[model samples]
Structures are given as C-alpha cells and as structure tokens.
Target: MQALTWWRNPGTKDLDAIVCDGSVRAGKTVIMSLSYVLWSMTDFDAQQFGLAGKTIGSLRRNVIRPLKIMLHSRGFHVKDHRSDNMLEVSKRGKVNYYFLFGGKDEGSQDLVQGLTAAGFFFDEVALMPESFVKQATARVSVEGGKLWFNCNPAGPYHWFKLEWIDKLKEKRALRIHFTMQDNPSLSPSTIARYERLYSGVFYKRFILGLWVLADGVVYDNWAAETMTTHIDDVSGYESYYVSCDYGTRNPTVFLLWGRKDKVWYCLREFYYSGRESSNNWDDSQYVTAMGKFVGTIKASIIVDPSAASFITALRKAGYQVIAADNDVINGIREVQNAMNNGKIMFADDLKHMFAEFSSYIWDDKAADKGIDKVVKDHDHVMDALRYFVFMVIYKQRTATTAKKPVWLR
Candidate 1:
C-alpha cells in the first residue's frame, strides 16, 4: 500500500525509483505495474514512457493483459498496436504513449536506443542483461522521470543486486520486499503447495526470497530409497519419451521416460563413452543403436540442440525429434523441483543415472565468481534427465492442454 502511494506521499515523492523484489506469487508484479501506470497517467500527459520485460511475449502475457482489464474497468480508453509494440492510453482527454521493449540480451540495448522516455517500468529486470537495463534507464531523460523494477530474488552477486537494490538509499529509490504472506488472495493450502515445489538453493531463492549462492550437490533431495521405483511397480503409462545427450568424444547418454498419473518415471537408460569404448559410433550408428534401444516403443525423442547430425539421423529414421531447451541453471532448477515434488522418479535399474547424481555438484570455482554452474564431469545422464524433466514434464505441467505425442496420434 505504501509503495502504491509513494509518489503522492510528501516524504517519498523525491525518490527517483522504486524496486520490488520477492518470492514468486508474492503479488509484486501486479502491484508494481499498477503503481507505475497510475503514477504515469496521473502526473504525466502527452508524453512517452517505456514498459519492458525479459521478452515481449512475456511482457504481454504477464503485464499487458491484466493491466488492460484493470484500465478498462475504470473507463480508460486503451489501444494496443501489436505490430508497433506500443500502447496508447487515454482518459479525461489526456493521452500518453507507452512503448514496449524486450531486454533479453546484450543486443536488446539497440532496441531502446534513439527514443526518449519519461519513465521506464521493467518487469523481471533481474533476468535482463546489464547493458539493456543501462540503455533503457539512459533513455529516461525527462526531468521528473522515475524507474520501476520488479523481480524475484536471484544470486547475491547479481548486477542488479549490487547496483540498484543494494544502493537504494544512494540511488534515492524506495525498496519493498514481499513474501507469499503479503498476497491476500492466496490460501494457506495453495501457498503450501507452492512451498513444496522447490528445494536447496532454489528453495532459498524462490520460496524464501533470499539472495543466496547455489552450492553443494545440485539435487540434494535425490535418495535411492525414496526417489527410485522398481520397474515392476510402474504401470498405466500414458506416454513415453526419450531424452538424449549426444557426444562424439565424450560420453553419450539416452534416458527413456514414461508418464503415469502425473508422475514421470525414468524407465530405462543407455550410456556409451566414446573415449572408453573400442568403437566410437558415428551419428548414424548412434541412431541405429538408439532405435534398437527404443525398439517397439512409440515415443518422441528430445535431443541436445547442438547435435545437428544426430538430430537429422533420428528424424530421417522416422523419429519425432524435439530440440531440447538448454538453459542449464533454469533446467536444473526445474529438474530439482520435479524430484522434490515427487513429480518424477527413477527406475531402480538405472545405475548409471543414480551414480551420476552423486557426482553432480555445483562448480565451487564458478560459484565463487558469482555464477551458478554445474560440474561438467560425469554429467551425460544428468543432462539427459534434465532435458526430459525440464522440456517435457515442466511444459506438460504448465500447459493448459496435455497434447498427445505424435506416435500416439
């Protein structure tokens, strides 16, 4: 409530910016966005402003849709120019232009260049590159221009934390921290369900809303007794999938997965080390071996994005192939969450994957430099598992429709 009235409050009117950082589903984005729009429409007119997110699609989905509804309820005229990626808003014969931008990468700085903005609102600012944020902020040259930032907590050494968040007083910015408790709409049971979705570093950052380093074992929740199931116990599988990590000189791995009753089971695995074997298979050879390994099972195959040759071979051999999403840190978090929530399990016979889990520790050297990276050794099966859980299961969990596999169709 204070954050919403900061601009009107005499004591905080002089602040140049507002930063809201907290847990997921903590009601930060909606409030921050509402406050920004109200502040703009009330204090400024016939001017230009900026609304940004990590990507334009996300900005539209997360902010624009709900924001438009809120404005319409209050009798404001809103016009969205999709091709131009801009919004025209007016009320009481007062009009303003709000341009949308995506600060996804270093190149995103160029998109915000050459435009003068009266103010800037960044959603999930922590996910954007520093260059893009700097460029966007620089565009706010209007005399009374202010900044608004909202995001979940990331690493302790993130650039945003060091510059904007840690220096709130120096930057003359108001900072508001929130948790699930702050959101009145969420019930105790709903909050508890979300709380059970994460563990380890992800739990500290996303659930507790703390800026902490990711260290130690990546999947600390993995235990043979609890996380593994015997193959005989798995039945009624509705869909099957194969996730692969292809390597020429290093080890290659393939993990077979099956879904039953909203839970995924790693039913089987195939691991081959080119360096350790007498025969190093080519792309076609690996494809042949994979076909034999997956014999008679109609399943969609998810392969590493970088394996062009292997992907081609698999596709030519009549396999439906999907290029896996390779966002390492996020993928690891999704995999860990799946394990923690009991959405995924491993078959007891998959010894290689179980062995790899014990060695899949966070890179301490990288952590020391404020980066979250997993150790590269003994990670083939681990990578395959991550691919399956993140790309297949995570999407299935969030998607409104559970589409059947091509083979099933």
Candidate 2:
C-alpha cells in the first residue's frame, strides 16, 4: 500500500525501475527491497528472486540475512534464507526466492553465470563498477525481469551511477527516489546524525534526495549534441545564461545554459580540480575560462546561492555574476518542462552532466508525501542544473515564469 503511494506520485514517471536514497534512518534499502517484491507481486510473478551486493559476505549478511528476518517476521514463508549465502522463499512448495552475492570480482560475474532470473537486487550500487552491473544485468534471462539497485551516495565520482542513473536521466530513463523521512519507523537520532554529517548539496542529495550537481558533474547540454568531440561552433535561437554549482575543496562546477526556440541547452561546462594558482587570484579564472569557451554567446551568468562567496569574489574582481534563483522544486520543474517538451540538448564536453542526468533520482519518502526531489545522495549535478534552469534561465524576472504546481516528478 505504501509503495503504491510512491509509485502513483513519483517525481519522474515512465519508470521501469526506481532508486531509493536516504539518510541512515531512512529505510531506503528496505523500501527498495520491498518495492522490488511489491513490483514483483503486481507483475504477479512467483519466479525466483535474487539479491547481491559488493561482496559475497555483504550479500549474505546485508541483503540475504536481514531480508530473511524481515520476511519471516512479516509472516512470509521464506523456505530457506541461510548464511550459505543463498535465500529462497516458497509458497506451497514453489520456490520464489533466491538471494545471492556479487561484486566487481571477476568471479562475481559467475554467480549469474548459469541461472535464469525473474529479478535481482544490486545493493551498495555506488560501490560497484558500471561494467560489473552491466554484466550482471545482461545475465538476467527472465523476460521482463527487473534489475534493482540501492545505495547511499558515497563519492564525488563513480562510473555505474554516471552511466545508468545519470545518463538515463537526460535521455529520460525510468526512475524513483526516496529519503529517510519516507520511512515512519526510523528513530530521531539517526535522522539527526545524518543532518549533522552532511550539509548543503551533500545533505540535499543523500538526506533530501535532491538531484543537485557535484564537482565531478559533466554535461554541457548547450552543446550541439549530447556527446560530441567536434569543435564546430553551435548556434542558437535564444539567449544564454550560466549556472555555477559552487565548491571549495571540491571541483568548482560551471555550466553555460542557453535557450533556443523553446528548448534549454547546456553548451559547455568548466570543471576545475586543482586549487587556484595564486591566493590573490579570484576564481574568475574559471569564469574567464568559461567566457572563452562560450565566446560571444550573449547571456547572463547565473549562479547558485552557495556561490555567494564566489559571486562576491567575482564581483570584487570586476566580473558580472547573476545569481540563480535556486528555488528547489521550481528549478527542477523547468528542467522537466524542457525535457518533456523535447527542448533540451547537451554539448560534447558535458558527459559527466549527462551521466548525472540519467542517474539522479528523488527520495521516495518525500514522493509519498507528494514532495518531489527530496535530496537523496548521488545526483547533485542534476539538482544544481535544475536550479540554474528554472530559478534563473527559465524565469524572466521581468516576467513571471510560472510552472506547474507541486507534483512528484
């Protein structure tokens, strides 16, 4: 019944799958695992179920073991859930469950080597490589079988998330999101701990399930094509604007957004890893780099609220900076509008951004309450981009840029 709430009012629709990211207290993993089973039930399949994670040990302990206790306690007839590193459920002697383990280990690929699957779980998804997940999914021969992944946002860089979650987002892949508040059973202490541990973008992504941009974010949607190495100049029919996802120790992210006809395009991004060369040197160097990259594209440069310091420095350094409005949901609304309207595109250099677009998701707990983009971890670039788009690019301060009222993506 609860899963239906999220399914009915998800942030992004057309989902064949979902991703639930939440704080430690949030039952993201539990919700996803149950959703896997719930979705499986709606599909009306008693076929074998599989669960795997970063290692055989983890799979056994985390996925298989706990799931067993959960099912058993819930009156589920789990015929066999053992530390033998296997889990199985049965109704009337028909085996319906089989939990297993896997990872980047070459041998992990062999776990699925010979078996046909109805569906499977890939836990700790952020830790696994994209190659490993791909190989495992390919091995699923059960028609219409789903491959589900659950993980907390772990790093500024990860390949699987970039490809599956991030890329699919731009192309508009099916997905769902969640956060700790979604689960009513969590203790307050856990929530408080997570709140204390993360802040700003990090907190938003992991705890809130917001799809903001991170330092490693790569996508310049304003480019001629999503991923072109071509040096040809791209023309546009609309004005241009820039959105910056500010970071200090992390890489500073800059995206140059442009509007053409009715679409929003990200032409290029300026991402810097190393520290500024001179202490006196304002970050304008990045802005300068972005200026050269965009050339004469006449558009205002919009930045996130976090960039207040950066913007101040830029202004002191004599650079023009237009701060992005950064209205959480409103920004996401604009991006969704551009995407659903088929008016968004990416530049070649924006690969990372593209990846984030696909991989980013919402916090399901928030979705259940009809709150979209609840700031789960893993997809910050997407969040930052949304702010840049709606709050700044899509809105004309001179004219009201009204968007759809609150709705889950």
Candidate 3:
C-alpha cells in the first residue's frame, strides 16, 4: 500500500516509477493494476495509455480481464475496441484510452514504438526483453506520468534488477518486494503447493523473492538432516525403479528408487568413479556389479540413451532396460521439483550422490555463449537421479495431478 501511495500521491517526493517484485499469487498485481487504472483516470482525463505483458494472451489473463471486471463492479462504463484490441473507460463524465501490446520476444519492441502514453504498466517485467522495456519506457514521455511494474524475481544480474530497480534513486522510483504472506486470500495449503512447484533458481526467485545469482550448487534445497535418511526396510514399497548413467572414464552410477504412498525414496547407489583408475572398466564389470547389487529384485531399469553397449549388456544379463530421457534442462527441473516438494528422500549411504549434487552448477560460459546448460563435471549420479525423476516419477505424478503435464523428450 505504501508503494502504491508513492505513485498515487508523489507529492514532494516526485516519483515516476513503481516496481513490485515478489512471489507468485501475491496481491501485488491486482492491487497495483487497480491503483494504476484509478489513479490514471483521476489524474489525467482523455489521456492515451498502454499496458503490456509477455504476450497478448498473458496480458488479458493477468491484467485486462480482471481489470474490466473491477471497473464494471464499480459502475464504470467500459467500451471495447475489438479492431484495435483496446479499451475506452469512462466514469463520472471522465474518460481514458488504454492500448494493449505484447513483448513476447526482443522483436516485440517494434509493436510498442511511436505511441505517446501518459503512463504504462508492465506485467512480469523480468520475463520481458530489455529492448522491449526500453522502447515501452520511451513511449511513456507524457509529463508527470509514471511507470508501473510487477514481476517475480530473477537472477541478480538480470537487467531489470541490475539497471532499474537496484539503481533506483530516492523519489525517482518506489521498489517493493512481496511474498505469499502478503496475500491474505491464499490459504496455507495453497502457499505450500506453490512452494513445492519450484526449486534451485526458481525457488530463490519465485518462492523467496530474492535476486540471487544462479551460479553454484544446482540442488540448493538439499540438506543432510532434512532430505537424507536411513531406511533398512523396503518391504513397504509397492514397486521399485533403477536408473543408471554409463561412463567408462568419467563415472558410472546406478541409483535404486522405491515408491510407497506417493513418496519416492533413494534406497541405494552403485557408483564407480574412474578418475583415479589406470584402466577404464568395461561394460561387463558394471553389469556384473549391477546384477550382484539387485540380487533377483524385479525393478524396471532406465539407462543412459547414449550407452547402447551398456543397454545391450543389461538386457543380456536378464534385466529390462528402457532408455532414459536425457533432456538436460527438463530432467534437472524434474529432479529439483521432486526435492522441492519433499517427494524424494535420499538414503544416508549415498554419499557420492550427495557430493555430486553439491558441486553441480550452471555453466556461465555456456550461458554467455547462448546455450543453457549445466557443468558436466562430476555429475554421473546427478544424471541418474534426473533420469529417474523425469522419465518415471514426474511423468506419473503430472499425469494424475497437473491439468496439463509438462512433457519432455
């Protein structure tokens, strides 16, 4: 509310911009949109304005739809221009014009150019291209006009955080950070559900509402006390799955998972790191080790897609092996989601897997080179974990739980 006042009544303070950064489902968007509309209508009559989102669909879903409902409930006469996709609002003999635009990509800047808006509102500004934001800001050249922005936090180095919000001078801008707690309408269960939806960078940005760097430790949610446990019994499990990453020189990792009552527990791991070995181990050695480890347990085996030799070897040894989904980003996301939701627990004996999780990090060079990837070092066990989560657990859970499952190749 104070942040809204900083824009609604910017008396001697002379502020022209308001930024609200926060967690999802916070009351920031609705309240700020209401305030922006009402204040604009009161301050400037018959003025041209603009509202933008990542896309037209999102703009309508996030802002225009709810805003129209709010306006009608308050007895304001709202007229739509279907041809231009705009709205002309009038109340108590006063009128204002609002144009809707999308900044879905960097190329979207051309659409917002040449407009002279009295003010503008940007939804999910952090997800927008920097060029589009600059173009939109330039369009709002009207005197005494302010810019309104609301977004979930991104990396600390994200342009919106580094340039506009962080460098903001007194009176020039009012920046407010919000969390799920700020919204009274959200129930405790709803908040917890949201918290479970993200992990690692997404957790930091979308849950905690912090602008932290997405650099090190891929699974930052892992802690020995909370996530790792010792379980001597597997009799309660309804089924089991095994995931393996076949590596000769790098490492070979096989993780055993047991599921009971919707919870997946990491029961054991058979790891072989050849970092210090003079001779690279053969596929037969891993196959022999795996056969001994399982000891007649009937579990569906998922193996690395690239390891045809290992796959053939496993099948020859009387084990059913399905090729694991190796889509790196999506796989990582599934594993992280499992960890975030407390659906996955690791056995205390899987020390190597824990060590790999701690060292896995985003590849800065690859990011700069226009590719999103994680560092491939010491990630053998991590890869196996990702494969299990992405292929089996996530697929099953989302099929039943989500409205539309996020499918990965």
The parts of candidate 3 lying over 4 Å away from their true place are: 10-13, 77-85, 93-95, 186-208, 223-260, 264-337, 345-355, 363-373, 376-409
Q: Give the TM-score of candidate 2.
A: 0.45
Top-down lDDT ranking: 1, 3, 2
Clashes of 3: 0
In terms of TM-score, how similar is model 3 to the real structure? 0.64
For 116-228, candidate 1 gives per-residue lDDT tens digits of 99999999998999999999999999989999999988878889999998899999999988899999989999999989888888888888899888888888878799988
Itemize residue pairs with steric clashes in candidate 1: none
lDDT of 3 by residue, 240-325 (tens): 99999988888888888998788889999988777667668898989888987777678989999999999998899888899998
lDDT of 1 at 373: 86
Candidate 3: minimum summed lDDT over ten consecutive residues — where?
400-409
lDDT of each: 0.88, 0.59, 0.83
> Model 1, which residues run further than 4 Å from truth?
232-236, 401-409
Candidate 1 residue 54 C-alpha distance from true site, Å: 0.4
Q: How close is candidate 1 to the true structure, as a TM-score?
A: 0.95
lDDT of 3: 0.83
TM-score, each model? 0.95, 0.45, 0.64
lDDT of 1 at 94: 89
- Clashes per model (N, Cα, C within 3 A): 0, 62, 0
